[model samples]
Target: MQATRTEEKTAETHGGASSPQPQQRLRDKKVGDLIAGKKRLVEVPYTASLADTINTLVANRIMAVAVAAPPGQWIGAGGSMILESDKQTGAVRKHYIGMVTMLDVLAHIAGNDVAPAVEGGGGGGGELERKMQVPVSTIIGHCLESLSLWTLNYNTSILDCMEVFSKGIHRALVPVDGHLENVGGVELMESASSYHMVTQMDLIKFLKVHEAELRGILTRRVRELGGLTDIVFGVTDKTNVIDAIKCMNSASLHAVPIVESTDEIGDDHGQLVNGKDRKLVGTFSATDLRGCPISQLQSCLHMNIVDFLEKLLDTPQQEACGLRTSTREHITCQPESLLREVVDKAINSHVHRVWVVDGRGLLAGLVSLADIIRMMRVWMLSEPA
Candidate 1:
């Protein structure tokens, strides 16, 4: 029930003594300071139309767009697991509010389940379709109820924020000055409203810059981090771009790996002997969609994903298709690789996730920037940043 507990606790504990200026005694500095540097929180009102939501996210190319899920209307995600009902009585678990992503917009546009139908069943499906084009607030009450919202205090440490993200929550909101902006159902403070969004990407950038200072954590192996998992989402190169986007949209992913087939994850393509299948070759992202003829993008949900990637890659074959210009490439690392190595590769390449390959060079899991920063087991690292 206490969504803003962290902020409230900090204010109560640091009352009067809390300086507006950064805390100097920590020597290394706190995550709170890092968050303070971010300048705005990108948000859309709960009343915003689905098209508006897509524009807000795609235009900003951000991980999350805040929905105005204010206190009472939404619960904050990822804090102490046992901090409920007082362990004095025994811990009571609670489900945190969920967050929204581009997937929501894409799904709505494509007619995918955005969460069970809001309100009562419609007498006429046509009327419901007509209503969807109207303001989102008509159905936002139900929509926000189903979302995961993470709330943290500006004073929360980097370590804690990492834990919050590690729990599978993509983004978070930190309460600053009390003047609130009613962004849909979510509330925001006026101080620096837009910068309130805290994503794993932001945290990764921080780690990259402080790599040396944080070597103890960075030196750990990727495989040792429990967060690393297999390439769970992918598709054959033949799947059309539209279907691929649907998959990505449903899973709320930025990109999906392109492979030969769902054939078990081994590089032993030699078994096919006379077969002409390509190996685990290239991957594509939503960003790649930008390279396609601008018009195609607006209508590309049903287009071939291969054609889209090809258009972006602009291969000799694609050039024959009238593609005049373009750009792109791939990057990956091994499970045994150190976090620092993955960190360097991702930073240098300006990519989001590094494919984790097996000893046989087969695709395994990915070391995503979000997953990298969210690997909180490293919090126990011996060295201090």
Candidate 2:
């Protein structure tokens, strides 16, 4: 009789911004300014087939490719690296290159072929040809918003890098400082085992080691559990109810980890977070909470934010949830639970976290849609980046 609140709210908020504009001070920043020099970039031949290139890149889920060399020189390299002849050619070569990404591959597949555009008469016509040879440096930071241009320098920090990635848009290029073309040390994947190869053996070993102390305490052990680390979710301390809606669209992940400055609370330097160098702050997981607003959740949900954030903040292990919350009380289990369980938790609960716990209330590793998909043996899919 209330006209279905979710549908009514969607109708009310569908078209545009909910609030009036605030003319805030804007920071002049580019992707180059945030380059942490951390991401491993692969250089492929300019003439590499789109299909082959996409296969390699999407297989690893890498963000981008530095298109270098031509079709001829790429034969021996097999679509990995490129070579340069001159020391002074570094700046010259870097600007001449175009980076390819999953978004780029999608764009290419969608038929926005920059190639035909550069060769002259194709839809956009003369403009594509004019822009083809234009220096990458010139267009690197040109933020037309729709174009999604950004830049990053070489010395940026990892936190800064994650911040850039959280923006949830495809960037054209990230140029480094001092005109360096090739940056080493950021290895995307070392070997097959180093990349996508995970087995039940590894999970069993990890579970055994962690749950060793509780061997006699817990009822049963879980074997063959694994998930993707990249698919993380969190909430923010900076956000209130209004801001929460804004951050939801900021990243691909379904949850947002909430954190506050430990320094502000005068807590010990790092007593809580496994003695890590970083501060011990709170975490909000979609598994722990959901996409619902804190106010609405408080009224309907059983637990509170402090209780929810505490679960993810604990030491990250299979049964980490047991350290704080009694898993038996909160978690619901169906013996018939499938991979879809993870997705259901994220969607129904509005959180991106799902955990595996045995009868005794000990922890098992968390699971997510990304994790379930990755572990799907029967599916034809690409590897994680």
Which model scores highest in lDDT?
1
lDDT of 1 by residue, 32-102 (tens): 66675686666666567754654555566563465553334433332211111223443332222334554
List TM-scores for all candidates, in order: 0.62, 0.25
- Top candidate by TM-score: 1
Each prediction's whole-model lDDT (CA): 0.52, 0.33
Task: For residues 309-354, write the lDDT of model 2, one tens digit per residue.
Answer: 4443443421422222222223323222444444444444333345
Off by over 4 Å in 2: 1-40, 58-63, 69-91, 94-97, 107-149, 157-163, 169-385
